[model samples]
Target: MQFEDVKNARDYIVYSQGMHSYSKAITKMMDLYLSYVPYVERAHQEGKKAIFCSALYPTTWEAPLLYALDTIPYATGEIGRLSDFRVMQIAEDYYQFPIETCSMVKCLVGQWHIRKDDPGAVKRILGVSSGCEPFNMAWETMKMQGFDVHNPDVIYRAKGVDGERLENLIKFFIRQLYRTIEWVSGSREFDEEKLRLEIQRKNRLLEKMRKVLELRLKRPYYIRSLPTILILNSGVANYFARPEEFEATLDLLIEELENIPVDEEENKKVIPLLWVGTTAQEFGIYEAIDQAGGALLGFRSSPNKLFREDVPPLEAIAYYLYDNQRAGAEIYMRRFLDEELGRINARGMILYGIIGCSYNSVEREMHRNYFHQKGIPSINLEGAFQLGGPTGQVLTRVKAFTEMLS
Candidate 1:
């Protein structure tokens, strides 16, 4: 289905046929999309400077800078459309970009080539090279292709190993973020006040997000309500523009959600599946689960205590980035699951073993063992990056899992 404008496309995507009902999840997503798509389009139209991040980056610092310049910040992996995904295939098959590389990187780099001829396309990139070699290599290739690039070197140190050393590293990252901000600002003077306001607004946004997550964990009703595309579009494109409006929408959502009581019978009808693995890019995996009367609660492993509303923006962001729970380190991952499983009242766990992700693939057995010991059955489903799975087989497996839980 095609739409005449971006807003229509966004509307259709967010309020798709079966999802036309009014729900807190639908309302929140609509609010986000209305703000998100237009902001990116306006930035593209006005020739405002934009930066493409290679992965998820802290937005408290990044988004404010873009807002200051009247620009937009985008995550290459999260923002890719279906066309971009197809371009990634062409890039791998025809252009000889490594097929074994990360799907996010492959699609993002491929999207760059597709948009390279357009004068309006964002040419500057901010690449994070701390983890994922494919992402690092993709940025290197983009640099070679003449895109202006900045990559901050970050090393992962296990928490509590060296407090002072960690503080020093965070300080270094703060400096790198400041430098990147200065560069992104171009001729405009860097505005600390604007950044402070943005950070304050983002703090509210995070608070709202936390509330939303908490609600979901407590009453996991909206799991399959929104498509992975819409969910991830907001996740990736969220930082591109307005913070206050975004926060307000979130506030509205939380208020609405708080009043809604859990439907015990409805909840009993379907199995709630706690998903662990890569971003479910296939989206069909989710649809299949829905068809089989399962709710797919996507990955959640945040160290909420590490972030503070009153903390310095740089420190908060650094802490967020450094949080092992956010990065899915083994110890923290186990802890996160342990904490969240009961909250969501999940019947089972599904570990999506991505082909290229050594991290999740290797941890599958450990996760299975852990879940099994807890008397919760779990299964490991293997697929390519971003859930590149055979649709029929994936659906079959999803049905089988649901049947088992039933």
Candidate 2:
């Protein structure tokens, strides 16, 4: 498929013109997303390997490593976002993947099938065996298709472990990072200074992101909900490829938010909501919420911890990944949700996820019960991630939820 045929490129262009059209910063972000695939293709022409990663893996650890290896990083989840239902259909219909598979995995495999014959496209996948079973299975399937797949076993048992065990787990993960580096670069030896510089650059980007989040908190409507979601999405994966360009876009957004005036009358009419669970690949989810008189003030999945500068760089990455994985536990999520709800003064919650994700299926009831005990109103919305736009049922449910909140 051509670049223009990608769903995100088309949607992002419409988004650029439709919402907050006055802000050149949002347009710059749209351009960044549009430029990503071409950038990877260009790098491939330069003989750099394009390595596929997952959003589940901490970019804090992987981004620096990929930089040091002189490779380009592209997440399948990011590709899923760029694709439309046609890719998902390819996975479901042609590949014979069960309809029960996670939407992102389907997109991942489908995208690979489309580009597997292309010499310049992604041929190497770097995956972790820890999170999301479907993603692991996807990697295995791609491996069966003769793609270069390296999935390192990183233990994710972060809860109920003793201090010694936790320390051991961190050491194991650090070793796995080296193993992955060796697998990608054909050697374990990488420039420590290059990795350290990439980490420093990542840290700077994180600081700018924090500023953007703070600006959103100060004036949620000033920036709008979709842009906030996109920002968090891009920030999660270290801007997909180019950290410097992503950082520049954040700088632009921060400046625009600081200068723009909050629409008080409009803000007064909109109910502030908190989004908890996986962000839907369907961009229309945010738009639906906005049309229903709700604005997503904060995301539960937003990064709360920064890499530790006081520790050794590798150790910091290990700890960050360990802590980050631990935060996915129910214990951490409960406290985090409460803090975010209070922080943003959100009136309601939107619990959203893909239809076939086991994690979301299990967490849906738990989250609903938890919010119930806290007397917070929430609505659960489940659908295929990138299969088309938001369903009418989803839009009606959102409208009802926001009306109830109002």
Candidate 3:
């Protein structure tokens, strides 16, 4: 069990305390807990200027904020990520936005919509845009909820950026980021040398975090989500001002990682199954796979990575400031079907086809054939993400598939 001070809203603090104390509801609430909460908190609280950024292709535009704040970073993801299973309103209270909105995205947006008691949210919310309807729709949803959303930064999908264009865009992003910082901090005199040094420092940190994740992937070194969360401070624009907070959060999580037992339970050799498609399914699907002796190694039928901003560093901050959304739904589909499918050595796929997401909604024919040619079994279930069916078909199909594999 990890030990640390909680920094989210009081409920989150209570949620954290409950988990550490081994409270009965912990199992149910565990998924909502920000595995890297303290680390994210630390990043924002550091002494330097801070701005918060959130997105899919964060590698791009976030760079400008990093340079501008001399320390700002990404916030850890919203509390209820796509995978939470236990149902209950921990974050969104339903008043912030219409319940008709996509539940998963709304789970993240709920802070502005349903759960508005916390005022700090107004201080650091920056939403990104991808070239998808839902991306803009979600932004609108936030706006409807009264969020002070600035114009979205976009990411393009025509082709992944490369070479000179990438360099120019990156430089442009830095200049735009300066404008944002000036607006927020109400001070225009930022030190140039500090910005450059911070960028170098950030590059080193991204590389280090990647390496750490690689290690965790290899040996259950499981960095405990803290360091990655700290790295996201780079994504959040305001963390620069609160370096200590980011550092503290990082320390708490890293400590958790170091203390974790090296032993990971052996997975069941169930049918080689793949989950294709996005919109986070109810929690425990992955945990179920792990506990039931099976694995959903990768996503297959899911939407692409939404709102990615993997643009090159800006030549001027304006380049960064512009919206450059990617059709993550489209990208993830091609990569999964066109690329990752054959590689995973899967026997079947569980495709959760979400409605209203045009990107993947149109790919049904392409994916079905794509997997079949690869000689993989697939099950398509059409329904709201968390609520599949009462007869437990999802679980039943999973069990049957695994039994067949065995």
Best by TM-score: 2
Best model number under lDDT: 2
Q: Which 10 residues in a row give candidate 1 its minimum summed lDDT?
A: 1-10
Question: lDDT per residue, candidate 3, 1-53, as tens digits?
Answer: 22234222333334344434432222222332333344445544454333444
Candidate 3 stretches greater than 4 Å from native: 1-77, 80-100, 108-110, 114-123, 134-146, 160-179, 187-281, 296-356, 363-368, 378-391, 402-406
Inter-residue clash pairs, candidate 2 = none
Cα lDDT tens digits, model 1, 1-406, are 3222213234345435336355654555555654554566567668766677543433223554456555566656455443345767856875577777656667767777776667776788876657577767777777777788887666665657457877787788777777766677654356666665655655555555656766764455553534433443344234435555555556666776688888777766767777776555555566567767777653542214434446765566666556536542565577778766776678888887555666666788888987899898887886643323345777688789877897
What is the Cα-based lDDT of residue 295 in candidate 2? 82
True-structure RMSD for candidate 3: 8.5
Report the Cα lDDT for residue 259, model 3. Answer: 52
lDDT, model 3: 0.43
TM-score of candidate 3 on Cα atoms, chains taken together = 0.56
Better of 2 and 3 by TM-score: 2
Look at candidate 2 and tell me the lDDT of residue 292.
74
In model 3, the worst 10-residue window by lDDT is 221-230
lDDT of 2 by residue, 72-133 (tens): 77756666655677888788898788988988788888888888888767788888777588
In model 2, which runs have C-alpha deviations exceeding 4 angstroms?
1-9, 56-60, 82-86, 93-95, 262-266, 325-328
Output the lDDT of residue 358, model 3.
45
Collision count for each candidate, in order: 0, 0, 84
